[model samples]
Target: MLKVKFNCFFWLFLLIVSCEKETVLKEPVIFTLSSDSGFIGSQLIITGSNFGSDKNKISVSFDQIEGKVDSVAVNKLFIRIPEKLTVGAKLISVSLVDKRSNPAIFNILKSYQVSTVAGSGLFGTKDGNGLQASFSQPEELTMDKKGNLFIADNFVIRKIDINGNVSLYAGSSTYGHGDGATGIAKFNQRISGISMDDADNLYVADYRFIRKVDLNGNVTTLCGAMNASIFSALLGITLVDNSLFVVDIGQIKSVDLSGTIKVFTGDGSFSSVDGPTESAKVIPFKITTDNQKNLIFTEFSLGSKIRRSTTSNVSTLISKESLKLNGGLTIDREGNIYTVNGDTIIKIDNQGQIELVAGSVAGYQDGFGNEAKFFKPTGLFVDGSNNIYVCDTFNNRIRKIAPIN
Candidate 1:
């Protein structure tokens, strides 16, 4: 992974001041302008300049609708185009408070044929920061309640605002924490899986521990058993009725913000021991909650499946089939269950039916015009707007699936 580190301001300042070569390396900026994968929007970034100077004063216009600059630095700026330009690419003009630039043009590529905040990250590829191939991996991704993007690689988690500029949220080569896990764990201890609560507070399930993180990346450990069951590998989490649901092997456990644990179901084990010969069943991969406050879980099998029951009774409801090799599972506000298997995305109605929503993608290539397709998919989630965000894992892209008109 080639790590490209630059300040978002240096692009605009164009001012190079040399210190001890080490000091100049601290936090500089880098700037660029490009269109999105679907070409419906342009992701404009201004780096190497002091962007966070005035939050309210930061704004961008695509010569179309108004776009608010999400994050600014001495090195980068991220902005999104409007929904009107869903078909073709266009030239985009970006302006800051005192700096304005001409149209910077580029082709937009689709992720699994879906529009999302993370399209094919080829811009950072042909001329990139070093981890070009990794961006194409789409490994682990999360979207905040407001629809911002957070991508996790080997040692880093990036926070991407609506405007599109991505900043490093966690991880490092020598400082901060170790890069042993795919994502950041809570309290900077064990690295495990990631999730956001209803209030958008970040939660990480590291090994057997669960911890809360503040906006500035501060972590506070909450729950974990030192010598616990296989259920300690918390893969997914969902918040409902003022409680938190965790998905491990063989069961869905409920924990409160105050740190209490209750086994909702299973023989009391996780993936490592989910089998009868072992302890429980096949491990639970992801979990979600419906609008009715019911807990639902997705597990990998020949035909992927999800089990639902009353939170208080892992003993109450029946376990239903969801999909094969399910990755990420989430329910929309309309009570629809969404799951991803391989490159296929499916939607299940409340009546227990499966339907192909989008992403029957067939090929893998860094696309420019119309040659883009989906590859390995890892993370999947749904926003409040009914827009589906997919981490096209292998293709190093994040795809968004919208209803076709």
Candidate 2:
């Protein structure tokens, strides 16, 4: 009888322990989120009960796209918004083992917000903030390390501070070729492109000449001259390391600080053959560099392609019949290329995937993503925060595409 009682007691104890374990492993329940809406790469904090302490066992997803868990606790999950999610309301859920949490509605904002940073939408040289400022054919844009923007505005170089204040950085109202102080120096009517170096010095493609403007706004001719045969037409200019690469007519040329110019790639032919520098032929325009220092440029012909020139050879990165590349080209810190096609801003990822970031029609309107409109948006610059600044040439305004707050 005692043995029978002992067996019953042992079985009852086992049943109780099993029930307790089941109670401990409860389903995750998300009660609140730090933010109900955010952009890609923004952090979101999820808080609720019964999430459990094991991060490996906890999984979070936004509309089935897995989010990166930055940190985790039993009742709280800190995660980053996942990329490639469609911009709209998405169901976010947390899963613990076989049990899933209640779905929470979270709105995903567009990757960028389009707004006018400066320019009065009129062609003039007035310098101020917001709509108080004006630009005359703003061509190319380059931002310094401190977030100050320099623009190649026809006959002068204009500057926009981080606070959106606009002022003339270089050149004079008189259109001519002269190198002196910022106020005294004169850039010809054709100021094609501008680039900045580590020292905040601006290297400008002033027609056939490459001019260097020091931090103190002193302009000096770096290379090329009226009588020099080294260049047919100076187009896009970019600074990679100690060398300045520029697109000259149908070829890519590199100019050293000592004013020495050499053929970096291409044989001055307009063909699209990709090979070693001697055998390659490219009709290059709007040159920039990737994180690997590989030269990237746009070829307006051959179905509008983006090509990369490595030390070994040149190759096509992206080529599509639908691309209408008419504006500037730039690369973000992540090596993603930002360029304009017609009135739209396009982003090409490292994997060659193409996405239209903003704008769908040609006009002058500011909104988000496709709702925005730009008229002949030319120069492009992606700042450290991934905010894009555009020279809306025909609109005569400098537009900014920034992250949603």
Candidate 3:
């Protein structure tokens, strides 16, 4: 019995040694991964270890993507995510047989936003896509409290709400030709511009005709004597302290809550003989109001444009710094004004300093975004995210420049 027991013990000890040797000699596969975290479009890397060349042999699990993923490389995996992923963190993991790893994490960021200059002469673009291949001729654009877009088309006026919903505020398509927006086939009798006051009432200037549309789309013709006429093109209008200021020819006309008219600029009519010779600049295109109640506007025809009291004592915000200015202008929450000068999007500081944010997108019409050429850029507006929205007229699109950070 003792001999048998000793033999069994020796065998057990030998078995333990063999198992230890086998455990230490096991082979391992190499694997690695990295991610670029700050782009709506991003890439993930998997390198160093056991991965099969066959696309079917590898499997990946991301927070929102799963697949026999496209192999960007043998070691580098390129992942193009959806735009909606911008609001969340993404984690990716890989598994082969029973071996698995903790997920690699990344945060998605907004690449850009979309907006249009009020009356930049370009609409949201067809297909309702602000960027895609689309068609729209916009006269003006404004945003409501909910980020809904109000655009004045040459013959009709439409509203694009937060969800990309478009409803007609006014349309001439159903009626005989009359002076209004959204349907006037001709600009001479159309709603040249539209806006909303602090009271949330929608105001539209139809050539020489001024009217207001309520939230329910009911239209009421406002004061016409102050706005009606041939030379009064009723191009741009802004609201300040319960008053509406309309830009006609070279003059800025003020209309009050009571429908009273007052001449704020030029000779009060197209009758003013100014420009080049007179310090009085006429034919300024769009009008804007600063938080300080100062009237900010732009002058087309490539001349000097500045903001001053009705008496012309102040300096110009849109200067003749030799830029061929056209289209729309906007002042941001920080008091910085953005303007379109030729094909350039110019950012002017509160101190009157200027910087070229994006320009000349037309030169890069090839869509390469190089040289930033703009074909007759018309409108400019910015969102809370600091994304710049440009109305590229001839391009017939609204392009958004999102902050890269």
Candidate 4:
């Protein structure tokens, strides 16, 4: 009886050990995915079991499209979603050896699309240019808080409503310097640059004058003379706080609401020199303000350069190399500068790295991003959504570049 009991106890101990080993081996072969939706070129993380340690042996597929494997471990894998995948639902799976994990559903985000927002052809006075908008040498443009666009069209400043109706905001058909109501005031010669203050009033620089037009169409000449020491043929204007900055043939000046004028840059001579306000500036074009309220402007001379100025009236050249030929400097929220250089849109980051953002060849063709062409494009504006608005000068149209998020 004793021997029988010992045999039974030994057999029971072996069975219990075998059950515990089975439990350890069975750890649920089920694996889990991190996310169900992602955008193109986005990195995705996947957690699973028995994925193996070799990255080369690991393979991942999204909607039958192979993803670039970034890392792989025994229980986790990382991959970058393929950029070329179509925008829609996709099946994602991970394969290791002959064991393929269960497929998961992933949705790709929508891509960007570029389109023409205003104007149809070169110099059209007829309404119904794309969105009931017309252009006759539209130069400078600015958007209001409501998304309405204000454009400087030759002798008159036109306002395009959100519904695309074009109407005169300031200036008349015949050009002459007169400060009155919007319907009575006239912009002599040609209007160059424009900016708006928090009060919804627009500050316009026309020829050798800087004028202010309020929301009710009241026009007031801020501080500029026909041929005074302040400016001569002003081309750009930017407002910071209570001060307004203007760029003319070779000078940048600041104007206060009280009509006080101060030369911040240039000695009224047209030549490239890096120094304080006593030095010369070579044909400065567009002017903008960075987050720090520093005045940034672009030059159009053969060896053009972008420069910045402090409120203390000190000037500093930002680029070591020449900008060569550029137009319309605009800054994003992050202080990155965007301008047009020889038919291509160039972006200069805060670190001073230059990159081409749009325009493939110099011509007149509006397609997708870099694949699109431009004709001496000038005026550039970035909206809150980062859509780039380009004033295709020679083409006589407002083109938009929408980025794929």
Collision count for each candidate, in order: 57, 0, 30, 0
Residue pairs in collision within model 2? none
RMSD to native for every prediction?
21.6, 11.6, 11.1, 11.8
Q: Name model 4 segments beyond 4 Å from true.
A: 1-112, 128-131, 228-230, 276-283, 313-323
Q: On a 0 to 100 scale, what is the lDDT of residue 267 in model 4?
A: 66
Q: Candidate 2: global Cα-lDDT?
A: 0.88
Output candidate 2 Cα RMSD.
Answer: 11.6
Candidates, ranked, TM-score: 2, 4, 3, 1
- List the global CA lDDT of all models: 0.56, 0.88, 0.59, 0.75
| Top candidate, metric lDDT | 2
- What digit string (tens of lDDT, one per residue) describes model 2 on residues 1-405? 999999999999999999988885678899999988777766899999987777888899988899988888768999988767877999999998889999999998667668998999888999898789989989899988888889999979998998999998889889888989968999989599998888898999988999999998889988777865868888899989999999988889889989999898887767898888667889987888889999999988767999999877999998888889878999999999999998999999989988778887889888766568999998999988888999999999999998663
Error of 4 at 284 (Å): 2.3
- Which of candidates 1 and 2 is the stronger one according to TM-score? 2
User: Tens digit of lDDT per residue, candidate 1, span 1-405?
Assistant: 123234556543454444333342122223464333333333556443444465566655544556657666555666654544434455655555555555555444332235545444552322123223335254556778676776654334556677665555654432242223223432233233577766666666655666566566655667776556534466667677667778665666778889888866565443322223223444567776778778676666424556665634332122444345547777888888877766677777878766555554655533221333556666777878777777776666666676522
The positional error of residue 267 in candidate 2, measured at the CA in angstroms, is 1.7
Name the top TM-score candidate. Answer: 2
Task: Compute the lDDT for candidate 1.
Answer: 0.56
Model 4 compared with the native: what TM-score?
Answer: 0.70
Off by over 4 Å in 2: 1-110
Q: Any runs in candidate 1 off by more than 4 Å, and if so which?
A: 1-113, 119-140, 174-192, 225-231, 269-283, 312-323, 365-372
